[model samples]
Target: MENERAVEPAGIRERLSGNEAVAIAIKQIHPDVFPAFPITPSTEIPQYFSSYVANGEVQTEFVPVESEHSAMSAAVGAQSAGARTMTATSSCGLALMWEELYIAASNRLPITLALVNRALSGPININCDHSDSMGARDAGWIQIYSENNQEAYDNFIQAVRIGEHKDVQLPVMVCQDGFITSHAVENIKLIEDSLVKDFVGEYTPENYLLNAKRPMSTGAYDVTSYYMEHKRQQAQAMKNAKRVALEVAKDFEKISGRSYGLFEEYKLDDADYAIVIINSAAGTAKDAIDKMRAEGKKVGLLKIRLFRPFPAEEIREALKNVKVLAVMDRCEGFNAYGGPLGAEVKGALYSLDNGPKVVNYIYGLGGRDVRVENVEEVFNELEKIDNSGELGEEYRYLSVRD
Candidate 1:
């Protein structure tokens, strides 16, 4: 409590939208470069930052790029030259940067990405969904999802420290739901500028491409002989990221008074039925959980904040006591069995002697409303499975029109 008071001291309180909060964060951090192209739901991030540049509020070198691909390419180049770099995108914009995403990760650049989660195009969506970031799950970036504007701001600030950790030099994506948290105004507490600056510290790459004395090489083509070995190293770094992220979180908690873990467990201790979900939907589920708890339902929720480098062992331990569980996905897995969260959770518990009977529910794609009633229905489904000790169809859709 003393630490929190010392770190925050009732610091700047503001009613700012998620985009504006992120913009303010970037201005405070004042990275060396911000190369970006605009896209909906995410466009305001760069747009707001550009204003900071115009007003000389921050000395960040703003690079207006031609496309999202070019934006990412410029970031890679800037970071390779040993400059702190950041950018923002959503949906198709993130899709456009797909190729470069792997390159940035493989090269081990500590570029912080402000990603607004949005559904990918087909029928064309400009709304919140996990499809964009979920599609890039295996691309080897540290992914953090925020539930609200406060979390969005906090995550972006913490991302810098996480990505630049000495043991884990990897890119980090700070994601928030489009239009939901992104545009919605919320009350947020901000750490003073000097505190954030001191926390993020300096970006001193061990051996950058421009280190004349060290003479290091980046993005060198590797044949089969060394390719697998390099991938192994990247994998190890990702595993290291989990611990590093937690360490950073602990440090952050001292300042913000808001604690975080890999996932947040709500009323899971004595829960017989539970749902594991991500982002804004978790908020809705919590409301449903509360109402159900009032009626003695023993329903609970696991809200995942960190998605990539999936914390299998920890998650298994968290949900082990629950008799039945539903792993909800905002995007379709399209695998015919379960969504990504379900598949990963199932894989994590495969070796457990007694694990919850888990099912998958695809919901809230393309900005579809996931009300408290919808969440209640899922808990009811879990209750049915818990009582019967039998599983029905494994994968289902919620709130979808037939």
Candidate 2:
């Protein structure tokens, strides 16, 4: 007991996988209920929790579910009963729970899930990609992507705070590349569990409509009169979630000494051109940007972390000095105009003044590589736009077969 107080809640270093990082981060909040299923890369998170429960480190109900659907069902039931709950899944596992994923959001349940990003089957490989996440893009959860192990750990810690915030009662999905991040090991300086316990504090379900004492109805059949307004209320909560995320991140920074907000801006202050990308590709682009700058070229990178409630204001500010931007996406929008990330960038820039010219580059499909060299090609394409003073009529493919 004296050791608990002597711990001092300080930062400690350890090598952790994306899955293990999430497990450690969630342990801080001490979830009361977990109904988890095993899915590739996602399996280790719950496995860690199982060990925690067995070791008597966390006094919580750990439910080892047989299937994804049942796992989600347990989460909904637990959250409805006013318990702090969580779960994890991937690809088809996520699809199996799709029906409940929406319900968790619409019911305003503050549950959190870690998605070890995976590639959906058809032509399958147990590797890394964003297909699983992009497929569930509109599932109504507050979706955020992480580039590396540090981000995976950091975002998972912040997710509970943001999702359970009084103004933003919504489910959250923290996404990281399947095998790329989920399986890789990296050095992470973790805050003491005691500090995180104090930082995240506790979960208190507010405005819960389900109660035996109050005799209130929960998830009742809504008629046209109330259905639209109820959905509007959900939308408002989602918007409020963005601001609450910033506040949670701000408070988390005070305790952990690591900072992150809407998106990560890299060397954009005086650049004439920029690249807007997400996930692990941003790490690739960062390398390219650094190389180009060393060659006396003006370039920067903007990495989008939060995709669900897109950060329009910060998006505009990050590119304020740039004259051109290349928005690269891993997944395609098929015949649509642009992929998810590209479309969001354009949506954010419509209101900006003197903004840079933006082009969409779709590449790295089906677990392909987005090596650092590919970003140089994107910058070359942006230069073509700069010199010719004409935006390309079609999307550019970076290092992909014709």
Candidate 3:
């Protein structure tokens, strides 16, 4: 299934932090509007982007709002007026935009949000965790998680196309682990400005408030009878996004020679034990899996990328063969059972009568470290469960103090 067209040469290599990489991508796209309120970790994104605006590098209208709510509100207004809009936020900042998040998605606005994942408040910590985006998982926006700076940049660029596609006109959240990827600098390859411009193309929305000839109303109060229908349509659009995301990734790979999929399967084909995880910890898990593989332990991993759509069927097929499984969550769902990701992965595998024995482990809350040794310990437990044929506690905590 190869295209005849020659792949474009790789883009220039650069050293950048996740925030800086994302800022560069936004500058290259030259989006119409960016209404943002600064938050820790994610604050650097708008900081860098605003500098571009001031330097005349990009003509994007950079609005410094008073709060995240105003940021999202302005984003909705700008997007409704037929502009390709975007914004950035983290943790409580994202929590503040909760209401407007649904508004933008329900209105079918393709607004891109560069989300730096952070732990939500109470104990008041600033670090890498999926609590921010995980809390907003059901908000109807398409969610894409990145593992590192390179992925953050690449995912943000692809988000524009995925969200704006006709069948999937929904807002998008391009997420990366706060501080872990956001503040950490790494070598990344960037697409050329002309290539990115041509790839994203023009933002010609079909029906907008600004269109004089096609006058229409948006965000009107929906009666109960129509509200359910509107919600149903939004759900269908989310379903459509799974296909659109893959399509966009194919095009992206053609141009950049970097392929992406719903999830990354690392040595999972014939493993006896596997771990299902997300975001930055996946890198650590991979190293652990490699070391275990050399020792002839049948261990592998499934790293989720597209979280909102959940890709349930695909995930089930990916992990169906494993005898024991560990699902890691960086946030506390506080359910006393496990976390959000554990819930989703378990639900995905529910129908399999002889599916892998699944164990949900809550780990790395408030930016606690996840080392290769820690991941290997998880695999060691899975091996024990496999050999003993006795399932222990289904819900557990990993690398947490007694």
Candidate 4:
């Protein structure tokens, strides 16, 4: 949708790295409490603010934690005390904080975190993959992705604004591509501090029945019968987040003069085939789609911005007109399915009355290079399987050499 509203403020500068932009956005909100244990790509952000704390550029508690687990615990405690909290980590650091992440969300705390995407170590090395994100997919926090430096900065602001919105007091994780986008310098436009402050306003924790003398407990112990209800409450809040995300995204575009939505479409309007993907990989697919269009191939691309709340209906609707859909997964999920995102893409479109035939392509595992040509290879395979009898269990590895 066109952001046909007020002009964005002028201080929105023209150049910064994705991490730097994220830092600036956090400063805009002036979080009441920001805490962290440094982890790469993401670690630099907390380091940037250390001097700010010492010189009082930002009035916030910069906690020194021995581990990422403790960092999240500190963030949760601060959040419960009605303070806006922020922290960031990647890979193992993210895994360490897994438990508290869920607790913060189930208790409806607006703790916004930045996940500078990095490959989780197993064979023991630091790199990039969606493994960490897919593992935490069910952690009850909203996961939003930024494909570039600007979106990283923009979404960081929106995450705080949306997470703290009264109707949607849910924890949000903003994922930015580790070194590719996070550390890469981009010509980013920074919205002014005053404008961002006005746009985000202030954090106001809702006064639930547990306030003051009421003495109600949060995450209170519950038997089987009541436990289901609490889960239902969480489900409903997730639903609320979908609507709020769209509303907030539209407003953000108006305020920053940049546009984004649940997804971005490139030549998908009337294409015969398309690929549905996420994160920085989508940028690769977009380039391939452009090349295909030039060669007269009817292929397009759909980049997912909001993965949680799945937006299944929206995804189906977006790909309805296409004849075949190819899903590219960047992270493997072992025996569960061919890859994590491929599994989700299948689930999202399987039930449609007459959806397009879909194919899953596993690519870029362990940070293996996946260029635009790799995406085209998958698109070619998808075209070959367009009218095949097979449907489910239809995933493949695009660039694997025998």
Candidate 5:
């Protein structure tokens, strides 16, 4: 099945917001269960999915719960019982599901979550940022991010196959920036229903609680004698996910005519300066790269698509030659060192004695606007660092008022 191909199918073109695209994808997959609780931005996903259930478009059991914690709890139970289950959430909603997040992964239940990325609250913000998802980076789930509505839809569709693969039975988070991509309308090409169904074939778990012949126990308390081994197995599953994700993307391209990779490198092959970023802001940075290129500056961008099982070796190879690099993080890690992304990139390149001089910039917190100009300024700073041969402040903030 590694080299499997499906006849390229004609796409149904439509203009839709990110939330609508994800919901429509869910309708097409038509999972056995969807345990839902509405949270702003992500609410539309379940809202649209519920309408599909109401109209007989899908036969999925739509369980509307009172809170996000219960939403995830129900998802874990349903998935363990041999049902294909999924749910949607944002910021605090995800925070509420904290415990179940680990439970689903530890139980090896491949539940999909449509996460509209929002800033975690202290001041109670309802805007775009990576804090929520970043905070759960170690929760033993696979994470894939999107730059726009099209990627959001495509990623969600592919997530099912990635998570449910026998070698990688872990939950998946299909994430998109809140309101930025989630609310903004854009033209997209959707796969035909038949093709989507054919691609995401079926969910047949080998060992499930529902199978009478094969009795099983899940979420049992593990003492010190066996707890570490269970954690180790989860880590190994995450490692397998990296290979599984790329294989799934290869097959997806056969049906959709769109190609995907662990990360996208824009003009980085012969570039001197580059920026590493994720999600919707990657679109803005592309524009900035173009502007800088026209002025005879060699600038490029690496946009991450598969965030979890963080493609460290691949990322190191991609940016090994660049003279200076900036890792743009939308969340504040407050580690006094740098954001999560910064820490990951630096750690990946630590073994390379001549690795690019890297710096981390925290930006776009609480839905603050990220424009081409701001991205260009970051590139300009990279150029200065390259020329000066001195990297100033390894950790910094972008567009924050002093």
Candidate 6:
């Protein structure tokens, strides 16, 4: 659906890293408050944004919080007070904000979290992985992933609109691969500040704790009588977000010329075998898919863009006709099955009468690389499964020194 009411176009093409892109998006939005704490890979986000604050590029009140928990707490309080708010964090930093993450969502505060995906500590490694955001999968935020710097910028911009939508007032997590996209510089087209400001519009909330005209209670403790209903409302709002996300994406495309959806289907129309994955690894899988396609093999790729509220219907429709499907997960779910993504895909396809044989592979933990050859090897496994007509081990590790 094209937004036929065209506004004046404003954008500039420039090279920026993922962190830079997100900071620039925030600058363009000129949010009311930003509670910032420093963490690896993601620290650059606030580091750059702080400069903008110091230079008076934007009016955002930059709160230099001591920890990620405080950062999110500040965001929640500011947002509750009817201020547009945002923050950035990664890895253990995100883990620290776990409790507040639930608070921000449950209270229906439309705060935007820029999460640069990284490995969570146990063996303590600092690099790119999905362990951070994936760990908070059930925390009630609308999660979106980006495959490159440009998508990171675009997702952050759209997140503000999606989370702030009247029907879907939920927090949004815009995730990008840590070092892969966050630290790596790339050419990106940026929409004009006026265009972005017009696109995002003003954050005139309907009801807030600080709205002097009308007083209302928020985040009040609910006993058993109303707790379940509150939970139900939160769940319903999440369901509402799937539709709002697509609508915002469509509107975003009208101005940016960069289209987005629940997921990106690459060469999947006639594919006999396909892999469902997310984030930067999708690029590697796409390259592998091209090679397999050139060899006359019917292989394809489905890159998940909107993860939370899972997009199950779209995924089920996209993969229903394939002969075999492989779901690639970058973080381990440790459910004795596979990663969270693989498990979600299986659930998505479980009701289909003649569902394709689905397999799960957990790969790239602690920043392990998934090269094109590794993706080809996974495709080879898929082809073998399709040909054999007998499902082999359903859960396996890909390129992990196993």
- lDDT order of candidates, best first? 5, 3, 6, 1, 2, 4
Q: What's the distance in Å from true for residue 346, model 4?
A: 1.6
Please state the error at residue 43 of candidate 2 in Å. 1.5
Query: Cα deviation in Å at residue 345, candidate 6?
Result: 0.4
Q: Candidate 2's residue-wise lDDT over 1-402, tens digit each?
A: 455532233589999988899988877778999999898869999999889889998998999888999999899889988898988888878888988988888898989999987777757756666777887788788998999999988898898888888888889999988877888899988988888888777776755445556655566788998989989998998899889999999888887888888988899888888888878778888888889999998989888888877788888877877888988887777766877778878888878767788888887776688887788988877888899999966477778766
Name the runs in model 3 displaced over 4 angstroms: 1-8
Q: Which candidate is the best by lDDT?
A: 5
Q: Which has the higher lDDT value, candidate number 2 or candidate number 4?
A: 2
Weakest lDDT window of 10 consecutive positions for candidate 5: 1-10
For all candidates in order, the CA lDDT equals 0.92, 0.84, 0.94, 0.82, 0.95, 0.93
RMSD of each: 1.9, 4.3, 1.7, 2.8, 2.7, 2.4
**For model 1, how does the per-residue alpha-carbon lDDT over 267-325 read when each residue is reduced to its tens digit?**
99999999999998888989999999999899888999988879999998998888898
Candidate 1 collision pairs: none
Q: How much is 308 displaced in model 4, in angstroms?
A: 1.0
Ten residues in sequence with the least summed lDDT for candidate 3:
2-11
Q: Model 2: residues >4 Å from true position, as ranges?
A: 1-10, 207-211
Write one digit per residue (lDDT tens) for candidate 3, span 16-49. Answer: 9999999999999999999999999899999999
lDDT for model 3: 0.94
Clashes of 5: 0
TM-score of each: 0.97, 0.93, 0.98, 0.93, 0.98, 0.97
Query: How big is the positional error of residue 323 in model 1, measured in Å on the Cα after superposition?
Result: 0.5
TM-score comparison, 3 vs 6, better candidate? 3
List runs of model 4 lying over 4 Å from the truth: 1-11, 208-216, 387-393
Residue 199 accuracy (lDDT) in model 1: 85
Error of 2 at 210 (Å): 7.7
